[model samples]
Target: MHIKRVFDVVVVSLAAVVWLPAVAGGALLVLLTSGRPVFYRSNRLVGSGDPTKVVKFRTMVKNADRLVNRDTVPVTNTRFLNIAPDSPLYTRAGRLLERCGLTEIPQLVHVLSGKMTIVGNRPLPTNVMNALLDEYSYAGDRFLTAAGLTGPAQLVGRDALTDSERLRIEGAYCHAVLDGYRLRLDFSILLRTVLIVAHLKPSLSYTEVMDLIARNSGSRSVVALDEHASPRAADNTEVA
Candidate 1:
């Protein structure tokens, strides 16, 4: 774990340095195109059992949250799916940001600041966290790690699965974490995410998610994730 954290710091630090220009350029585009804040930072719950803000490029209207039609779909889930190659809500520049995954560039800052890992469970919104704790407080152990900008659940099928299923995969990943697992998962996530962004068919399935957990069980026993964990934990922050 120590080594993986160190590796995360080093690799993400370098990414931030090399991509600083693009990050800035993207932020500029958001600012110019949306007439809103360039960066969208939201209060999220991460490991250490506390709240943190996750950052991303602002892709929706500034008042999106207030206007979110919960009757349609949860906002957090929509945020992930909205980036699908066809979502019509994305601003022109937002489409380009999503296409290249540049919207996530701001998370490199979080990696540098020790607030998050390059790869780990996605942070949940504070409301989501409260709901999870209320329902399955015993699973706090799973939430004891820093929130990640990416993770195993993401690698398999983030947008494809229902929120409950996504949290199940994350819970499995957390329990099975060991040396080299983070690196391997991060690499897999990056490759898969890039492929999805490129509009290629993703090789993903529920069976694949189970297979990853099985391969990495490593003395960790599998327990069912709380049914409500996914909806409650959906939320993000910039590097602080």
Candidate 2:
């Protein structure tokens, strides 16, 4: 875990060249294309922590959450949520940022500040997470580690997974964090995330991804994951 934090610091430091320009350019785009409030701040529950004001470029209308969103599709078998690759409410600048993956550049601040990590589970909207927990109380296992920019769940887009599968993978990540975290696993997830952002397929199939996780699942089982019983843990502290 300590080493993972060190790695984050080192990597974020080296990426300053790209980070500075990207963040400035991203913020400028939002301001020029969209109106005021170039940044979006929302209280989100990340890992086992309290609600935090997560930062990102504003991607929707000023009052998007207050309006009914028509672009989201419900997650299969879960009465709790709707997710989508694109939303009708997204502003033009927002869509461009999302496409370029610059919408989250501000979040790098959290990573540098030790409030978040480069790879881990994502923070959930209060309503969405509440609805999820209302259905499956065990989903809380996700709080076991720090919130991530991307992780196993992100490797497979949301629509491709069922609610159970999502929960299972999330819990698996948490389990890995507690006992299975490894540097190699962290880089593997990072690489996979890059592939996805580039709109390229990962060299590993879904089964292979799951298998790699299982192989690294350490003995320090802290949570109950998997639809069957035990889950595959992270070989390294994957999302911390």
TM-score of each: 0.74, 0.84
Clashes of each: 11, 8
Q: Per-residue lDDT of 42-81 in model 2, one digit per residue for the tens?
A: 8888867679989988888898866642224443455335
Candidate 2: regions farther than 4 A off: 68-80, 203-206, 216-224, 227-240
> Per-residue lDDT tens digits of candidate 1, residues 183-221?
555566556665765668465675576566556555244
Model 1 lDDT, residue 179, Cα = 23
Candidate 1 achieves a global lDDT of 0.63
Query: What are the C-alpha RMSDs, in order, of all predicted structures?
Result: 6.8, 6.0
Q: How many clashing residue pairs, candidate 1?
A: 11
- For residue 63, model 1's alpha carbon misses the true position, in angstroms, by 0.5
* Best prediction by lDDT: 2
